[model samples]
Target: MRRGWICFTFFATLAAMTRFSIPSSAIAVNRSGSGGPVIVSIPHAGRIYPPEILAAARVGREQLERLEDSWCDLIAGQAADRGATVVQAVWARAVADCNRGEGQMAPGEVALPLRAQFSAPGRKERAGLGVIPTRLADCGSLWRFPIDRHGLNWRLESFHRPYHVALSRELARARARFGHAVLIDLHSMPAIPAGQPGHGARIVVGDRFGRTADDRITAAVVEEVERLGVSVTRNQPYAGGHIVSAHGRPDRSIHAVQIEIDRSLYLHPDRSPDHRAVVRMSEWFGGLIERLAGIAPGEDEVPLAAE
Candidate 1:
């Protein structure tokens, strides 16, 4: 039995180093809802991979898909039913991660024009989880060779930039309709292994240690998730990402918060969600959105300047 498990692991890792052909297209941003104060950004839920990317990739489809926050779109999609705007990327994160900043690249790495100013590389980037991932967990490297400048540029222009543009547009629309807007960046994390420090926490709420969002919003989210009988944590393991840092401006009345749900809550072993689990989680998310939408903008909150 031990030998069989070892062999399976080996083959899975080997399989992850191949490629799969896919249709050609830029990143697709699926949007819904008329207008609301809340906007949900599910940046890592995308599964589509352009053929060009697949052709150049050293990793297989399974490994790339493993990087996804699987089924997060379905959870965040519920926000739309509550009249909140939803912006989700359809291009896989391995191509270009919308949650990572442009400058989160390794030394000598080439990429597109900066959409935002540079910030110091974060833990994720250092761990090979950047705008364009260079490696996968358990499977060492993701690329057979360094990506050429032109290919990097294509990913930036075709996938990364478009995803951010759509998200910004939705935020702008939400702010225009409401006095202020709050962005709920939805994601899912792997379950904590037994005996880990955060093993008990099923949800993690990150607001960049209060820099990216208002305290009231974060507190309310923690409260909501805990009420559902899920363990919750704050600013541990995760504390927001590039999306929250870029768009969160509480003083500007544009708050952003990152919510990380434990994958075990909704996903099966294969990373697909059971229908009953999905429905239950979706209902919980819908209620959470409604509550968040009702939060009155703080005195410091101000409408975004006309772009």
Candidate 2:
């Protein structure tokens, strides 16, 4: 409910001066400081949904609830204070996932889902992590019946569209002001998948195999967090998702990297609260962020300006 504000500064020969103004309210934009070449986006943290769609959900409230990134907002919510704008989604991922590409297909694709439903290619779709998930975690069947085409369209219009629109604007603003933009897509993942090898490293960074961002930028972020006593790995169980695919255009001077923090490091995967770890991790992230903010622009590895 708290809209972000933006600070702009023109560093000419004049002494320190900055412009503070209310950002566009069309979508929530939390402004922190003047042009800083960084934009932190949290697409999976939204929890709001339209009343009508919530009533029509095939899955029970509890099942839909558990799929959330869970406390992601609390982790990176203060990005605005560190000279970056944080564009957080307010709607629940169950309502519509902002990280998913538009028109992502589900299991019963040939059945022709309603216009509102999203259909797309990518692991999120194959893994049932679409705009409307086919399953909750590994559990079966979130929907009781096929969603009507008409109903599907409503979800897109209400939830999916607004979040992306807001993100696009912020990214554009960052690009305009700083001549480059680095979008840090922040998220959290469940530790140790069921029946699989445990994740040896706690923080996983995804740059789409170096296609989504400049290698040096990714290295800088990874190196900084690793210095804070956090084990860092690159592109393993989780690579970049839709947000990375859609916005990461290094050739265009916009670099995006997906940072997945293993939840076990901070929270009890058994769904219990671990306030101590959360606090420590949160503090560690704040330090890591400062390192990211300190990265200078115009590196030889920085991507060329986009067309």
Candidate 3:
């Protein structure tokens, strides 16, 4: 497997640069030139589970696999020569969900002493989808053992912290060189529920109700998806998550949005990538990146120095 990261995979004049880290290798950072203004974040595509994580699980591979975004990585796998940066985590989300914040742990998920670090568990955390997933719908209590302080720190340092740190750094670098930046936090979703607004939609774009990005970004996303002959919706049921909240700073010319692709559109029943669908989605993203790279933010959205 590709262990090292900080790479650049190009489209027109493509070149990939890699930097190596630890724990199932590191993230893949593919740049083009100065890495344009767009950064693509694949937080949940991780498939590699260390022996420790698998051994600690009460559920089998199928239930553990539920934590993955499946093959979401391939959607943006080849946005070459387009100057968009892609930061992809290779470790499985079951190891440590990258989209969740550090404080999302439940009181019972961690050892008693470390419980104070987290506030009251939110709906997601309580439901066993927190930073370190503790339960699933039918599979109650996911771990064979509780999360002690060493276990908690190991995950944070090895998985969660590294993913976010790399993402933040790349976003900052893109913004610095391009005068502004946008993060496309990518993920895959199960079919939307029957009554949901985006139930029949093939793609859903989220910007946390206009807080994480300019309206223009969302508009551009919707337009691009429609151009590919796919139905799209916005902020329906699934808005952006902790990744958007933590990195999006439109106030400073850095924008972020979450894009959820319905798995049925591109995955097999077993959650593997459908090659044809993957290629179509890849080309869709490639063209969209080119188009978006050309869209300038508002004049008032100046790049301010950090305070």
Which model scores highest in lDDT? 3
Q: Name model 3 segments beyond 4 Å from true.
A: 1-24, 299-307
Clashes of each: 0, 20, 16
Provide TM-scores for the models: 0.82, 0.79, 0.87
| Clashing residue pairs, backbone N/CA/C < 3 A, model 1 | none
Model 3's alpha-carbon lDDT is 0.80
Ranking by lDDT: 3, 1, 2
> Model 3, 50-83: lDDT tens per residue?
7657666778978988888998989887764556
Instruction: Give all candidate RMSDs, comma-separated.
Output: 8.7, 11.7, 9.4
lDDT of 1 by residue, 1-307 (tens): 4543443344334334432112234444444444568888888988887655565556688887888899888776577777677777788888888888777766423323442332455667667787788787788777655544545555676667777777778777777777678899999998867887567799999999999888988887999998889889897768888899999988878899999999888888888887788888899998888877777656442222321
Q: Which candidate gets the maximum TM-score versus the true structure? A: 3
lDDT of each: 0.75, 0.66, 0.80
After TM-score superposition, the amount by which residue 133's alpha carbon in candidate 1 deviates from its true location, in angstroms, is 0.5
Candidate 1: list runs displaced more than 4 Å. Answer: 1-34, 108-122, 193-197, 299-307
Model 1 collision count: 0
